[model samples]
Target: MADNDLEIFLTARNVLVELRLNLAKAVSAGYKKGETETAVKSLIEVQQAIDVIDHASEELEELDEAEHDED
Candidate 1:
């Protein structure tokens, strides 16, 4: 893989990691505070991030395919 490809992949992966960590922390905080609603809200945020990342991944795949077609 090219260096640029590796960088993009790593960045995307790091985003996922950060999102998961933030979500986990939110859940823990909500539980500690006995706030189910807040926890659920945080989950929604996490789901949105997952959706965004999934979309980004799909786009990247499409781009790669297009590049290969050009070659």
Candidate 2:
């Protein structure tokens, strides 16, 4: 990957990490406040986001490998 692309990926990954952490905290607080339904919904969304990130990261790795093979 080009340097710029790598930088962008890193920045996105960092933002996702931060978001995940914040969501976790929110979930914890929601549960403590007896907002079970809302907390569960948020948790599900967080899981979905993580899944998308994982899929995208895997696709990128595959593309990188293919590029190396072509080289």
Candidate 3:
């Protein structure tokens, strides 16, 4: 794989992990404080992170296909 593709993949994966951890923390804190809104917001953030990673993966796949076409 190209260096750029590898970097993008790694960054996206890391961001996804970060988001998951953040969501978990938010849920824990929210429960402790009895704040449902905070937990819901955290869930939304997790979904956004997932969408970003999915888009990055799709773009990488397209780039790979284009590169293969030139071979």
Best by lDDT: 3
Q: How many residue pairs clash in each candidate?
A: 0, 0, 0
| lDDT by residue (tens digit), candidate 3, 1-71 | 66577577768778877877877777766465546677677778877877777787787778888999999
Mark the regions of model 2 whose C-alpha exceeds 4 Å error after superposition: 1-10, 30-34
Prediction RMSDs, each to the true structure:
3.8, 3.0, 3.0
CA lDDT for candidate 3: 0.75
Clashing pairs for model 1 are: none
Question: Model 1, 1-71: lDDT tens per residue?
Answer: 44476467658767766877776777766455546566667767766776776677777778878888999
The order by descending lDDT is 3, 1, 2
Q: Model 2 — TM-score against the truth?
A: 0.60
Candidate 2 lDDT, 1-71, residue by residue in tens: 54456566667767767777776777766456456666667767766776776677777777778888999
User: What Cα-based lDDT does every candidate model obtain?
Assistant: 0.70, 0.69, 0.75
Q: Is candidate 1 or candidate 3 better by TM-score?
A: 3
TM-score, cand. 1 vs. native: 0.57
Query: For model 2, what is the error of residue 53's alpha carbon versus the real structure, in angstroms, after optimal superposition?
Result: 1.1
Candidate 3 has its poorest 10 consecutive residues by lDDT at 28-37
Q: Give all TM-scores, in the order shown.
A: 0.57, 0.60, 0.58
Please identify model 1 stretches exceeding 4 Å from their true place: 1-34
